[model samples]
Target: MTPDTLNFIIIDDSKLDCFIADKIIRNTGKAGDIKSFTNAATALEHIKETPPPADAKTTVLLDIQMPVMNGFEFIEAFEQLPAEIVGGYNVYMLSSSINENDLNRVKNYHSIKQFLNKPLTSSALAAILEEQAQ
Candidate 1:
């Protein structure tokens, strides 16, 4: 599928961060429908509920910390989701935390596409979309 067909999800406790990510992804002109969530619990449920098209491409910019559920918790729940549903999208951790432990923990989840620092950039979003094209 092409970039226009892609659907993205951004999970960050801070609404401002989510807005920034959304803007950057759009500025890259590679994203179509990008959804942002403040909590992982709801986002996890959304991912499980909505099964994306097989050929469709999607990306998720996840935050490391949040109320109720953190990014790691999301990954755990995300992994439990059926492959047919969760495998459709690529997930990346967008965090401001510089803790090695957090980074190492996220790495444990193979599904994580990449680790992005705060203030999502266009280049990162483009790279992710380009990767999904392949």
Candidate 2:
């Protein structure tokens, strides 16, 4: 599956990071609608209030560090949502930190598809697409 066929939701405290990720995803050509939030709580609210279309496959790019609700907290809340709602999306944790503890903690969350390094890249996006295609 190509990124063009998937919707993306980017949650990061850094507005600049969100912009960069949005730009990278858009460059893929025909990419689906992309929404970004600097606050994890707001993002979660949006997810609850506005569910994606039934046929849409949504991928969430979440940052590990944030002010109020961190990525782990966000995942915990997300997991509380209905299974049907949760099943429509895949979550990826993005962090520049190489802390072994952080990495290990990420492994505890079954909702997280993978932990990616900071600065979203086309190659990483492509890899996600390929993995989803399986």
Candidate 3:
């Protein structure tokens, strides 16, 4: 999808990683707006309050590991959201984790489109867009 047509949300506990990922995403020149959150709870609240419209293009890049509420916990909460809001989102797990168990566990979330290794790369981003386009 074109950057101007998509909203990107990056949730990671590390400030530096969030910054770097934001930069990479901006470099693609396809992101309409990018929002970053260091905590999952706050992000979850925003999502709950302003759930994307059903026809809007939105993608969330979430880190698997975070203090308090991890990505899985966020997913659990997200799964309970109204279908109208949830239908507009494409959730991807973006993490530095290489654990087989962690990777295997993501399959439980039907909402997650894919589990991506970070830091996010241009090629990987392109692949995501391309795949989604198809």
Candidate 4:
């Protein structure tokens, strides 16, 4: 697979955080497209309206807390998405809070491949590459 051809979505209430993650992804020269949304509803709607192509290999870096729908709510809404796209991608949670309860709640989601702390680092990016390699 061409890793650079994959798309990514950042769902976070903080635009600054989104910008940082976007920059990191771009710096790595991976991912074909990157989209950011401040709210879960709009992001979910976009996913429902124009789903990514199966060949796109998309990943989402989602935040667990937001004004509208939280990450868990987003996941629940997204889980209802058509199975084709559901089966074709991954969602990784990104958060600054290290609350065990929150982490536990999110773990219930099978689609969530991993959790990432804020300020996406080079090592974290490399780890993703390693996971992809594995």
Q: Give the best candidate by TM-score.
A: 2
- Model 2: which residue pairs collide? none
| Model 3, runs deviating above 4 Å | 1-4
Tens-place lDDT per residue, model 1, 1-134, is: 35455778989989898888888877776667889898889888888788786667578888988889988888888888888776787888988889999988877999997898877877777777777777
lDDT (C-alpha) at residue 81 in model 2: 97
User: CA lDDT of 123 in candidate 4?
Assistant: 84
| Candidate number of the best lDDT | 2
Q: What TM-score fits each model?
A: 0.92, 0.94, 0.92, 0.91
* Residue-wise C-alpha lDDT for candidate 2, range 4-91, written one tens digit per residue: 3778999999999999999988987746889999999999999998877787569899999999999999999999999988988899
> Model 2 off-target regions past 4 Å?
1-4
Tens digits of per-residue lDDT for model 3 on 40-71?
A: 99998988888675455588999999999999
User: Which residue pairs overlap in candidate 3's backbone?
Assistant: 3-30, 3-31
Candidate 2: lDDT of 101? 98
Each candidate's number of clashing pairs is 0, 0, 2, 0
- Model 4, residue pairs in steric clash: none
Output the TM-score of candidate 1: 0.92
